[model samples]
Target: MAGLSAMEKKLAEYKCNTNEAIQLKLVRFPEDLEDDSTTFNPEYSHQVFGDDEVAFGFKGLKILLYYNAGNLSTLFRIEYTSKVNENFDCVEADDVESKIRKIIPPGFCTSTDDFVSLLEKEVNFKPFGTLLHTYSVHNEEAGEDITYQIYQADMTCPGFRDYHERLQTFLMWFIETASFIDVDDERWNYFLVFEKYNKDGATLFATVGYMTVYNYYVYPDKTRPRVSQMLILPPFQGEGHGAQLFETVHRYYMSSPTVLDITAEDPSDNYVKLRDFVLVKLCQDLHCFLPEKLMQGFSQEMLTEAQQKLKINKQHTRRVYEILRLRATDMGDPEQSKGYRLDVKKRLIGPYKKKQRELAKMRRCLRPEELTNQLNQIDLNMQHEQLEESFQQLVSDYRRVLERLAQA
Candidate 1:
């Protein structure tokens, strides 16, 4: 809610100014990254350099930025663009360092060579705790059983808090805000996913992905565990690991007495899909959301059951209700299909109705011609078509989730 800090403001400025003519300021010192300690992502460089910016071989340069423990580390890697360098107005290392210090606070190494050497050092990343949950899924295509393990660790865990710093750097590459949270605050909880396989008569583990949850206090003693950043590394995506991680976190909170309903912070489209699937799966087991009850239409029973049994809030519970109801309705029956469409349409029309009310209130303030012009822009005909199209697409999406739910 607060305004951006000086470093964030400058970074934003840098992002806006990036072009072929603008030379990179961080290229002089790799350790001069914007150190927010709150977020980082290598892909974010694209925000400044333009999407998929290519460096034609050592004639060009690439700049990377990351933050750890309140220290910024900038990386300047060169490619084959030597001829390209002669045309740009490059700043000397001293000026570049002075420019960086204006934004990021003081801390950490300022040497590019030392930073490169540190990256060259080998580091081991593995499961941070004993197994919390394990399940085997049959990969029909491969004709093999794949095993996944979910592990839990807190900020208080020995060596885990520090190890998480190294592990979470992966977030910078995938998540836009890849910086580490303050683990010393002791309010963050971590969940990790790993795949177990055997090699040379020994067991091996590969890091699949992870999620971070922050506990926010409600009135009195209750706590809300809001999911922060969740990443299923590219190699582990497209499988059901996301659902596995989400459901595991949901179940963990469901078992705790002091925790309230779970929530997520600015979830992406993929996460929303995975969450809907998992919530539907979990809700199906409750009596209130059974096929018979879902067909009876939504009621307080469904909301109360979902909140008490699964820690799902009322808004999400309503969404789950629509999805389940769609699954229950048979499109072959024209009457049942019409009822579902009407239900979804009513929700879709809410924004349009609100706009109409706003326009009516504005009638007295505008000239007759201006009012006519504004009303013409409403285009109710197009709105109706859009509403129907949206409802149809929604039903199609719901069907896909239902099919997956049935398989699961």
Candidate 2:
């Protein structure tokens, strides 16, 4: 038993955290090759590594996946101080390289010298689509305004489909549950953002990030465009690129008469905050959401105007209304704060109220034994506690939205 315990301790030394081991870089210049500032780590590795996101039987592992910022031509390399192999006999190292190969597409350069050579071709690589909007953001580090352009592209565009395959690879590292979409589907719409820069007296564009929307057919004629994926690469995040990208996409859909509404597929918490900020900013300018109307409470007028003008659906409009309403509410006044809390709680209680109605009907129709089982599932006192908890959480989220809105 003592020997076995000693062997286990020896094996534990071989483990490496995959998240730290994986290093990504978007190389724009030769100097960036040696710059640590250009490197960013993946937010997640569980999808590539195991759920624990650890690689077994490797000591001091570093997986470098670097790409040309303009064309995203990749260079893949792995370095390790020690790896468990036949010498261990009782243990084997994880097949780290093979797992990474499955995510990165074919035709990637494995040689550093060869990869550096590919950067020369980036000067000729231009963004592939019609430019929809152009804007500049102040880069604090650079101390100058950097221009970015958002473009609308599809599979039909020449070379875009191939470029997108390379682009989507970043999603795996950044998004927790990211998956590639079927570019073969004609209904998919792609919105890409690129940084337009002047390189060697010639203009060049570098990939910032992208979004994919799937237009699902709504009953008779309209289509509901659901945002399937949105990713602003790690390097470009916290600079307001996401808000610009989201607003641009939302406005693009708002102009289309056939678009029923805009929605998102399982939005992350960060995405929700982005959406709220954008929606509130958009609605703030609308007459229906003016302070006078907002103070009157959420109305059918607000819903209709938002849906008709902005292509925002009912549920989203209601949430936006509550956020805007909270902004207009005077929290220091006891009467005003109570009204705001009760109004939000009423919306929060909707699901429970629905279940209660179902329970009442079940009491009338279900067998006594069935009703007893159903009654056991719900406790009114517990629900009241839950309702209060939900209301508090929602108010907290609303305040955050208001805070961001104030900054905007």
Candidate 3:
């Protein structure tokens, strides 16, 4: 046991945290190559590294992947103080390079000088597809208004497929459970955001973030556009880029006569919040969602108007109504607060009601002995507790939406 403890202590020194060891940078100029401010780390490495996200057999590890800001031409390098080799015969070092090579495309520059040379060509790289919208955001830190543009792009666009290959590599880092989509499918639509800046008296563009939507055919003639993936790089996050990207995409589909509604595939909490904010903002302006109408409770007219005006589906329209209703409610008034809580709790009880109906059917169909087992599975008091918990959690989420709406 003493000898085993000594060997274990020695081995621990070789393990490196993959998330910390990896360094990512988006280089805009030659000077940015050495600027520490340009660097950011990946939020996830488990897809490349294992569940623990550790790289073994390196004492001081630095896995550098730098990309040109405009075209995303990459530079890959690995540095370390010491590495485990044949001398540590009992344990094998993690093959970090091979795993990364599979994800990062071929033809990446291996030297800093080569990467700098690629930056010069960035001036010629222009955003692909038809430019749809342009907006400027005030960067408090830079003390200047920065301009951004959103473009509707597709795989058919010139040079976009190759650019997308490099761009989609970011999904692996930023989005959990992200996988490469079939760009070959004509149904996939791409929306991209880029920062338009003037360098050397000429306009140059840098990639900020992008989103992908896949259109599924609805019955008869309409189509349903489902947002599949969205990502805002670390440097550009917290500046309303995500909201802009999402809203732009939503509006783009709104103008189409054949679009049924917009939805998302396995949306994260952040995405859901963004969606709620956008939907409420859009619905709040409509005549059907006036304060008096919201106070009256959700109506078919509200649902019809939301679907017709914004292409919002029934489920989302109901949610938007709840949020708008919460905004109109006066929590200070006991009567109004009670009405609002009951209204929301009614919706929250839907799943439990569904289960109860199923349980009733089982009771009629199953034998007494089988019914006993089923009855034992559910506790009525616990069900009430869960319903109250869900209702509270929902109100908390709605309040957050209202706060952001106020700020907006």
- TM-score of every model versus the real structure: 0.72, 0.95, 0.96
Model 3 residue 147 CA deviation (Å) reads 0.5
| Predictions in order: lDDT | 0.66, 0.91, 0.91
lDDT of 1 by residue, 1-408 (tens): 245485344333232222332222211122433333322223343322335433221223333333221111333332222432243344211122333233333443445566645432312334676567898777777799989899998866676765565456556446764455777777888998877765345555656778999999999999999999998765567788888889998999999988879999988777777888999989987889888888777799998889888999887898798999998889889999888888878887899999899898879899999999999988889889889898888888788888999888
Q: What are the root-mean-square deviations of the candidates from the true structure over C-alphas?
A: 9.6, 1.9, 1.5
Query: For candidate 3, lDDT tens digit of each residue in 329-401?
Result: 9989999999998998888888889889999999889999999898887778998999888888888999999
- Best candidate, lDDT-wise? 3
Q: Model 1, stretches more than 4 Å misplaced?
A: 1-44, 47-126, 138-143, 176-180
lDDT of 2 by residue, 171-192 (tens): 8888899988888899999999
- True-structure lDDT of candidate 3: 0.91
Lowest summed-lDDT stretch of 10 residues in model 2? 83-92
Candidate numbers, best TM-score first, in rank order: 3, 2, 1
